[model samples]
Target: MTYTAPITEQTFVLETVAGIGEIQQLPAYESATPDLVQAILVEAGKLASGVFAPLNRKGDTEGAKWNDGAVTLPAGFADAYRQYVEGGWGSLGADPVYGGQGMPFVLASAVQEQLTSANMAFSLCMMLTQGAIEALGAHASEDQKQEYLTKLISGEWTGTMNLTEPQAGSDVGALRSRAEPHADGSYRITGQKIFITWGEHDVADNIIHLVLARLPDAPGGTKGISLFIVPKILPDGSRNDLRCVSIEHKLGIHASPTCTMSYGDEGNCIGYLVGAENAGMRAMFTMMNHARINVGMQGVSVAERAYQHALAFSKERVQVKRIIEHPDVRRMLMTMKSTTEAIRALGYLNAAAVDRAHGESDTEAKREWQALADLLTPVTKGYATDMGVEMSSLAVQVFGGMGFIEETGAAQHLRDSRIAPIYEGTNGIQALDLVNRKLPQGRWKPLFADIRETIRALPGDGDLGAIKPYLDDGLAALENATVWLVGNHGDGFDDAAAGATPYLRMFGIVAGGWLLAKQALAASERLAAGEGDPAFLKAKIVTARFFAEQIVPQGTALLGPITRGGALLFALDEAQFAA
Candidate 1:
């Protein structure tokens, strides 16, 4: 099945539900007019479907090749990258002052979804560079920006984040990378970084590495860690004393190199400090947060691809009749469709929150939006990724025995999606962040209140019928869970932590339902007015109804685990696992 960019669907979400109109009204995003937005979406969709989608299967088959200390991407990867750069797709959401188009990230999110769906392995390189651009623009010195930003934004060069070491997976403080200061305002970075995505490749002129290392006099742990710009080529046109010693053989996304990098083996590798010493964790997080959301988009991206593939397969595959005629197959397809749309909606909503947080003039409004963004980030990352895995698995189930074979391409999606939940912070960590970091901010009252009011404002049975009650009940369950988590945080934290994963899932269920309900409402109003495509609008209504009926109920069940699951979780002894 050909990968078609869901431009119409994405546009509906953007304009109807994600508040792109309000985003346009904001002076910061004045360039994002309706026409411009449409053009960008259309062009991006073309690039995704025409160019990137074609390489996906081949990339998976050929993968990236490692020869000596260098890595070569799959055939056509370099040319496609050249096209991506020439088209200025890399600079879409970057800062304009440094040669970026300065598009809103919401639009970027949509484009990224298309790209990832079309060709996940190929697009990983671009996504990492985008994260690097964000980090550098936000934290790098003016001189550093002048040196690196334009090239990075223009895609003449690429970038990587090197925080993970052999000893340090999620524990940044445990990293053993070192940075020794030099007299000429630079540092000699010596470290072994592992699992560095797009860490080494032939596509770009230079690869700028944002590495985390401890200075000699640095105190300890994460507080002593510092971020440095370690480029493959020095500014003076010399090779840095760094090499990609090896690239990992991964389960999926084989076209993208995941390298084990060694720095300063020959001598001291020159590196430029990014921010204040010991603030490496802070600065890296700037990139990580950016990467996390993009990872969520990755989940949405792969899900979309898998869903399309499965939908096509079902219609053509006959089992007594077309599999599409099978009720179970229809249910599976509905689940995949509704879940993908829900995740897409949540991703866009997060992007819009990001725009509001960035563009709003009022401090309080900005803070509120920022809080909302922060809250949703974990849910989006964790829930969407978890769903991506499930959706892909369902896609395989739809294909039955054929899905187990590589030739059908269903398994590739499953493989590609598995890494998302593991990297950019595990989904477990995301859940912890949701419960311990995000919810602790005390921002839930207003958000929860808004969810309730939105539910209340929904039209009655005439318009929504059974959908209204399902959504209402979901909100009620979510509200109860929120109250339980918040009220019990003081005395019930242990249980809360144990239940964090399900709580996050519940939150996603409600949030996705709420957003889908908003879309359904929009479609309902448009249908009543007799102004839009009746088929599309009718489908939207049906999808939303299915989500409310089938998915929303899961939120209610999570409340028990959220309030009472911790003791049982901890009941098992550390040694009991061996039994």
Candidate 2:
């Protein structure tokens, strides 16, 4: 089935979890007025629902064709790109000076979720362009910005992040790509970078490639790496010395080109440095923070898409007989619906934390929320994406044989979702970050206090008894994990990493349940006033309870090893069973 952008759920999430216009009350976020945000969302949704949603299945089936130096996207992509540009959706959250709409990243974050969920492959072009725009905005010289950011922001052109060399991968310091500095303050870049999304496409007049290379005298490892902007089209509209060497035949996200980019083959790949030479890592980080959050959004998007499809499929296609006159298929259908909604709540809460971190006026308040964002970012990226892929698989199962057929479109969601956990620094890395950095930061007491304080602020009325019990259970487990980390920090440091993946998942389930409950209460308030849909509001509360009853209970089981399981992993013999 073709995807329908979940506009109703998204609108509810924004008004409830994201709490629009609340941010506007702060001086730092004064620009995030509800009227402005609503207007931007409406315009952005037009592109997502009207332009991209219709083309999702077509793009997947047709994919992108690569030949020589050019890439031909699926038939409707170029038209959609033109529509995105016309609507200003491409640059909605970009820096203001570059002719972008200057919307809040938080506001755009949710909209991006809908677009990517509606169509991942197509949305990638816009996603990558945002990264390149940030790189240029943060580090590019005035001339570079004046010449590049404006058009890129206007969606007249596109951008790509070129960091993965065959040898480098995640180890940027191991890269062999060379950059020879010329007398004209430019470098002649040479070598190959692979997995470059939208490296070559027909929709834009120019493609800006932000690449990493090493200077001759530079120190070894990452210290030697430098960032450079190598455009596909020169300032004079001439060809630059970079070509799409070849595109990969991937298992998933077929519509997005993952090209092997070869630079300086003609010895004319002149590129300007951004920021200081060899400080490329720092500059790249600016783009990484933005990309990391956006990548997390991919998890949210796929999960929502998968959930909707599964729910729709379960309701219409009866599997087991009805139980007590109510269809048994309805029971399975409810599980998919409830699980998906819970995941959606988890994702939006993560975004809200990010926005609060950036917008809160209080320094201490900012630190607290920002730390919460840091803690959840990895969980959101790793757990949510994993859930998305799994959810898509379940949807296929629910659809039975028809779902396996290519024309049904359920399989593609699973395929596309598989890449998210592997990208944006991978789930393993996110897990490591969660354990090594986020878990032990600023001592555990402060984070514990923050949670307790938040719980204290929640409404203490009759309807919340269910939430209180769940929250208590979750909080108790969290405290146990916290105390173990703090008291035995060093004892477990060398032997606890094996459980990192489980640790993140445990975090996500409990935290997600909590967010779901909070959202339920907010929804109930609207329902009481006859403002929002009662089904939606009731759905929030029911799913949250189901999550607590069935899902949140797993954290207790996962705790035994997460704090001290590395010893077992290290204990495995190197040649136990060589395959």
| Predicted structure with the largest TM-score when compared to the true one | 1
Which residues of candidate 1, in runs, are more than 4 Å off? none
Query: Model 2, 264-368: lDDT tens per residue?
Result: 998989898988889888788777767877887787787678767766665565436422235444555555665666666666767677678777878999988
RMSD of each: 1.1, 2.6
Worst 10 residues of 1 by lDDT: 457-466
What overall lDDT, based on C-alpha atoms, would model 1 receive against the true structure?
0.90
Give TM-scores for every candidate, taking all chains together and pairing residue i with residue i. 0.98, 0.93
- Superposed Cα deviation of residue 327, candidate 1 (Å): 0.3
Candidate 2 yields a Cα-based lDDT of 0.77
TM-score of 2: 0.93
| Number of backbone collisions per candidate | 0, 3
